[model samples]
Target: MAAYHARSNSFPSRQHPLIPEFDEQLCRLRSSEAASSSSASLSGKLSGLQDLHDCVDKLLLLPLNQQALSNQKNEKWVDELLDGSLRLLDMCNTAKDALQQTKESTQELQSIIRRRRGGESSLSSELKKFLNSRKAVKKALHKAMESKCAFSLLNRDQEVVSMLREVQSITLSVFESMFFFISGPKSSSWSLVSKLMNSKTVSCEKVNESNEFASADAALNLLISHKMKNSDSTVEENAQKQLQELEMCIQDLEEGVESLYRRLIKIRVSLLNNLNH
Candidate 1:
């Protein structure tokens, strides 16, 4: 009985030692798993922080790029506007100069017409002299026409006709240009005066057209003088109206440009506020 009791106690002591060692081994395994989990979490957190930093860097660069692009566009727009303004100024100056030149020409033409009216040469005597000279010229022309020298006569006649036509065209063009400047209703208040002058000239044309040949020539001369006088008066009125209209248009344009500039400035300010937010 004593030996059996001792054996039992020894068995208990050995089992107790094994239980402590097994418990220590289990603790070590649990600690290793916890350490591995912590390392994985730390790695994940570091990776996440790196991704956030990269995203932040990209986000910061995006606004800078947009700002740079916007600045370039604004500079280009400003340059274009400056160029356009200079061109407009040049055009305005040119128009002003043209207006002055037109005024001066109209004045000179009026003086010439007045001088022509004051002359008292009888139309009958002038017509008679002209007819006599024309008769001689006609005889000479007929002689040339009768000649067998075809090339020479043809060339001479063509040259004279061309010269006369050129002179007439040049005179007509000058008269038309003057009329446009002086009598234009779009530019000046003189349109009323011009219209009144036109009525008088048209009446003179009717009178000349109804007269007998000899008296008709005299009437035609008188009609021409009246027409020239009317034309000069018309031109002066038109030019003034045009100038006034141009000035008004310029004023409106300037106001519009200023409004646009103010609106653009406001838009830029708004954009800056949004970027800051």
Candidate 2:
């Protein structure tokens, strides 16, 4: 759970878009009662979405987590999860691209206004500041993109739409499985998991075929280890092995985020430099 926490400062990441929105609302809320009420309502709605995202993250990791308990029984299901996660990773980039495009559109709109103003009026200075802010935002986004390694499977932003559809297909399949497996009449024991599964926020439609960040081979090895022994020590050893691989992937994801954050920090620096000048 703690592993999934995002950085405090940066653009809204795909993983926790609400957090940034919440923060922005908080800043506005500081100035007005109306803003406070609006933000509070928004926060309420965001919480549900946050719950869904977090649950999806955990479900994505269930195969590895279950290995820790010596109960790896689902090779086929685990493989499916792996495939979904791979597609998810590829799709996550799409989410980021969408965000960038949205920001770019906003900047372009501001640029048009800035051009029309042409620095003739009192508000021209403010318009110039807005333009500078937009430039800085673009720079930060570009720097982040430059610093992070591209997704190995897919690199083009033009593919984001199709890739997103693919991800949604996988998500729906996962939700369908969870709906039946955890929420089925016979599976009352998994009620909590069932509830999360039922969350309206997470679902994907059918894609031809797709997949996750997890390797099928590693998952298979873990399954073998669990079947070979029920002893605590054996499970512990295998769990540790799975942990090592999971951590590396987690770190890679973190690095991608860290780049965006670091670039944002530089944007602040650049902003200050411009103000001083």
Candidate 3:
């Protein structure tokens, strides 16, 4: 999709010339996401979003852009932009909570595994609890994704308003992917464990390994199942490895999401300032 609406000939040449570069960054993010699911892919996507928002912040700060957005006829689009910002904030917050919950649970499980003296009974009990926590997190993420807002088609001639809409569009798309990776890919018929198992090569894991969330879940489930069946101790080692990897992934995402949350707030504040001005 076109990342930003092209300005008409009548608009001044100096008015937000970053729009083209913004489009380039947006396209690069989408392409990178489609090509890989490595640890670096998620970080790259978040970094790309930060850059895109920086461009948007600059656009919002432009005098002509603010003036055009504040025009009486463009009030509806302005309200829509504000509303869109809120939706983005809500989704970002949901993602943060889910990641934090998963991180804590994963860490606890890892600690339990490390202390093999805790005995098989204790390990099994903690495994079940960890799986249960993951199930709840998945349900919450699914609900948030389901309840995400759809952008309304607003009729507006102003380039500034169109850029705002594009920002919302791209922001939502990136978050949807991040949430899917964090929560595992969507499936209607598959149960929590089954879905993650089956989704290894789906949207988020086509080219490479499953996302850390899904991979960790699958490994844990497999380890628990083997334990129930009196399997080898090797499985426990692998499961611990997966949990450690997942913890690292969560840390990177936690930092990235926090930064992006601040960026979203900045964007929203700029929009509100325009409305107030």
Better of 1 and 3 by lDDT: 3
lDDT of 3 by residue, 176-224 (tens): 8787787776432134345544543222232124667777776677666
Q: Quote the lDDT for 204 in model 3.
A: 23
Candidate 1, 1-277: lDDT as tens digits: 0011122211223243433342343333323332322222322322332332232223223443234324543344323333333333333233333334433433443344345543534422432443343234334333332431211111122221222122222222222222232222231222333443456443333332211212222332332343455335443333333323333432433343333334333333433443344
With candidate 2 superimposed using the best TM-score fit, by how many Å does residue 109's alpha carbon deviate from the native? Answer: 2.5
lDDT tens digits by residue: candidate 2, 1-277: 1121333211223454444443344333223322222222333323322333443333223332234222233233333334444444333353245334434433443344345454334333433443344345445444433443322232222121122223334333322222221112322223322332344421222110111112211222232332333332432233334334433433433344334334323323422332233
lDDT-based ranking: 3, 2, 1
Q: Against the hidden reference, what TM-scores do the models get?
A: 0.23, 0.25, 0.86
Q: Please give the TM-score that candidate 1 achieves against the real structure.
A: 0.23
In the predicted model 3, the residue pairs found to clash are none
In candidate 1, clashing pairs total 9
Clashes of 2: 14
lDDT to native, each model: 0.31, 0.32, 0.76
Ranking by TM-score: 3, 2, 1
TM-score of model 3 (CA atoms): 0.86
Q: Please give the distance, in angstroms, between residue 69's alpha carbon in candidate 3 and its true position after superposition.
A: 1.6
